[model samples]
Target: MLAVGAAALVLPLAAGAAPTAFAAPVSAPVLRAPAGGYEELMVPSKMGPVKVQVQWARHGGTAALYLLDGLRARDDRNAWSFETNALEQFANDNVTLVMPVGGQSSWYADWTSASNTNGQKTTYKWETFLTEELPAFLEGYGVSRTNNAALGLSMSGPAALRLAALHRDQFKHASSLSGPLNWNAPGMREAIRVMMLDAGRFNVDSMAAPWSPAWLRMDPMVFAPELRGLPMYISAASGLPGQHDRPAGLGGAYNTANAMGIEVISMVSTRAFQSRLNTLGINAVYDFPSNGTHSWKYWEDQLWKARPHILNALGA
Candidate 1:
């Protein structure tokens, strides 16, 4: 009788908490069509309010695609919008484009702790934000919480695969463009530390202790088996310069060289990830272009190529 009365008393209090918990989201701006353009949103998160750019489906479709940015993501706009013609290319697609801005050096992962460096004011809870907070709010906009896709380039490439693997119920299609897929590889931790430091002086230790279970949890290769039967598009380019690399001066030459080296690493890592998937009997589309570099041009091309597959997977 005591247990029964306790349950009955808790029901009303629990019901009361629901409105309080969802009060902020209830007050959030609604998704309104802007006459065939992008609509900006401020999604509430534990880290803070995050700015997200959205392009509603041209034909009023509900399927959404999340495009994650690189390590040096900017606060003003997502690279997919400014660096590439992704917005224009997908303007008429029957899928919503969700691009989150401002996550410099954050590999779209939940960090262990908040860093006080590089103007980081809150703990990076990106995984939680994407999977939990953002999805719940998007449901209000007629988007299916489960029927969505995720794609990323460079640093966020592995993150897209990892998110899809771990949260299979949320993401139906996943793609990686020029992403370093192997996180536990030798020297990766140190390399990531240097890169993160250079990007925004972020401390890699805050992401996860080197090689710890937390860090390993973010590796796409470590969770390759979980991606079995999921639609995946993996692409990488050779370090050689392609039509996109036009060296103009010393600065252009240096940039091209840097892109070449980065592309080489990405190609090797993507190949290893493919091999791991093969061992697991997982099938995925792989694009190993003959000659290219780790630049927006190559990534832009990959995005175009992956669109049909992504649409097919989402039934959009």
Candidate 2:
């Protein structure tokens, strides 16, 4: 079995593809934007008013790209804002960048039950919020309910695809950056359990029962057939340290080691996911780097690579 401890350290921490023929570009809706480039939206959901940071679409276009955070999603701000330059990079793109903050260890799923641990009181209803509530609210901002894409890293990587798979009408484009697609894979549940517990004192059982249908419901491999025609970009890197894995100190070294192991796990699962898609005759742009770790630098690089495809798919 893999060492769950080191993997857990990064689980709390957080691909390239060629062009695929996507659906016909959807026309942009009339956009409503505050003069400020960015706006904070309080979207109401079963969990309560969830905070979402929106970078308005540039040039008056209304196509949106939803960016989901990792397992250790911050309650204060989405890490994409601070960890990467995504906001500025997409500043001039016609697509709106919709980032929902604070879903730590939630996997962006509709949980089976509430976890009172680590002060989590409300039942997680992220699947509903992202698919149903958020879309309805964004429609008022002139963002098309149907013109959008979903991209995520680490924990949310599988989530991005799952969201697109189950709700194809909402997310036309989907991408996973170093996310393990198969949850039912051996040792995956234990790793997830360790990571979830370390990240937020969360219990995996509260999200889904062991080997339950709910678990399979979230497994991308199981839903691979659903992803048949969607435009997809998937990427992963070898666990070996790359240029970005340079350590500043002992703590940095330790974190780097954890990140490496985590990436290896992701790499394995991603390949399995790719095999499943291949078997299903689903086409996706796949990138497997020679060396890298589970860090923001690689995810940033992959996102930049995937940006063009995302814009094209959303017709942004």
Give residue 74's error in model 2 in angstroms: 0.8
Instruction: Compose the digit string of candidate 2's lDDT tens values, residues 287-315.
Output: 99999888888888999999999999988
Against the true structure, whose lDDT is highest?
A: 2
Local accuracy of candidate 1 as per-residue lDDT tens digits, 30-92: 664233556777889998888887888888788899999887787666778767888888888
Model 1 misplaced regions, further than 4 Å? 1-36, 116-119
In candidate 1, residue 190 scores what lDDT? 74
Please give the range of 10 consecutive residues that has the lowest summed lDDT in model 1: 12-21
* Cα deviation of 95, candidate 2, in Å: 0.2
